[model samples]
Target: MKNSTPKANFESFSFSEDILSAIKAMGFKKPTDIQLKTIPAVLEGKDVLARADTGSGKTAAFVLPLLDNLSNQNVYLRRGRDERFDSSKRAVSN
Candidate 1:
């Protein structure tokens, strides 16, 4: 992971806006133990392997960070059908 730091206890870090929004929508007020440990590591793009008892909030740990990064990208959709078709053809040919 770039800019890796010492692993932090789950209670120490804060989540970004989109994550907090989704977490609230899912009715989670605080981070679970796995969430605490995994979120920071994933945010740093580090390779992680975690094992936990079933029904833990493992899905949110990864989903939140991925959504956050994708939302921040400077991507613009194609403006016309021709542009979209051209792009798709290029992708398929490549």
Candidate 2:
């Protein structure tokens, strides 16, 4: 299998401190391929459809940018927050 590490590290991107801290806490030292590919699109408010085998950090690939987007704006709350996104566990269930 090809290596998945991206050329950029977590801090290389202009992520807020909260996201950076969370990534660090999660022991994520580098961006996986999916993360590298999807994070920018997600942050740019572009719709993304991604597929990868299991254990590919798919959850974080979306969740980190989602959290950043949500934190950067309250649009979701104005539209009536979806309970699914209220918690990570709940998000996966839906």
Best candidate (score: TM-score): 2
For model 2, the superposed segments whose C-alpha errors exceed 4 Å read 1-7, 74-94
Q: What total of clashing residue pairs does each candidate reach? A: 0, 0
Superposition TM-score, candidate 1 onto the true structure: 0.63
Candidate 2: clashing residue pairs, number: 0
| Predicted candidate 1 versus true structure: per-residue lDDT over 1-94, tens digit per residue | 2333433432344555655666678787777677777778887777878877887988877787676666556444554554422321231221
Best by lDDT: 2
lDDT by residue (1-94, candidate 2, tens digit) is 2333454887866787878998899899898888888887777778889998799988988999888766555342222353334321223222
Q: lDDT for every model?
A: 0.62, 0.72
The runs of at least 3 residues in candidate 1 whose Cα sits more than 4 Å from the true structure, single-residue gaps closed, are: 1-14, 76-94
TM per candidate comes to 0.63, 0.68
| Residue 3 Cα positional deviation in candidate 1, in Å, after optimal superposition | 15
Q: Cα-based RMSD of the predictions, in order?
A: 7.8, 8.2
lDDT of 1 at 57: 81
